[model samples]
Target: MNKPERVKLFLVDDDKVFLKSLEIDFLENADFVVETFPTGELCVENLSKKPDLIILDYHLNGIEKSAMNGISTLDKIKAVNADIPVIMLSSQDKIDVAVDCMHHQAFDYVVKSETAFMRLKTIISNAFRLKKVEKELKWYMNKM
Candidate 1:
């Protein structure tokens, strides 16, 4: 039997305790490779190492306190790697914010919940599988 691919997820949240708790959950239950950063700036700085997916909070402390807000951080990341999937987490219920995030090409926007976490795991696994197949097919085509 073949082993499953482990999903590499980078989590960015200003709340240190939240990040630590998520790191624990990802390790203990989801079997994912989780790296936690207290802020998006650090995550972006280290992203040259490249993570398969990113989980970001909508409101981050110490980020640009401007009209753009989370979109600014998201923009910085997307600029470097347009294809890297990003999932947004927010406690806010404002439709405008969610709409703007999705409009900016976030893979998904989610309000944190137990169900959401499980779904995140599933999505990560499926996305990895899809990307893997695409890579294989591209290689085969190049050889042909």
Candidate 2:
């Protein structure tokens, strides 16, 4: 018997405290192989590592005044590998912001709140389940 591969997650947030807290939560409660990035530029640069999922901050320039924002970074990630699922995260609860991120191909939009971790867990599970279905469909199609 073999252990399943852990999900690799890239968490991109400019707020050091929030980023660390989220990282710790996932590490302590889940079996994720997590990586944290303070700037969206760094996350974009490391896309070659091929994370299974990305939770990106909406305002990535909060600390780095000149850093790429989450939408910009999301665009870059999609351009590199559109198949990778990205979940846009923010402290804002604006509908417009959520809609905009969805327009950019985000798998989901999560607002930072007490329940965010639980919501994220559900979303991550759904994303991987969808991917598995798609993969099986493709395999069957190829067999035809």
Q: State which candidate has the highest lDDT.
A: 2
| Lowest-sum lDDT 10-residue window in model 2 | 61-70
Candidate 1 lDDT (Cα, whole model)? Answer: 0.80
Candidate 2's residue-wise lDDT over 1-144, tens digit each?
Answer: 999899999999999988999999999999999999999889989999989999999999987788999999999999999999999999999999999999999999999999999999999999999999999999999999
TM-score of each: 0.78, 0.97
What TM-score does model 1 achieve against the real structure? 0.78
Estimate, for each residue in 1-144, the C-alpha lDDT of model 1 and write its tens digit: 999777688998876777787788789997678888877778888888788899888888644453234566788889999889888888776888889889888887877665667777777777678778989999999999
- Looking at model 1, the pairs that clash are none
Clashes of each: 0, 0
Positional deviation of 96 in candidate 2, in angstroms?
Answer: 0.6
The C-alpha local distance difference test score for the whole of candidate 2 amounts to 0.96
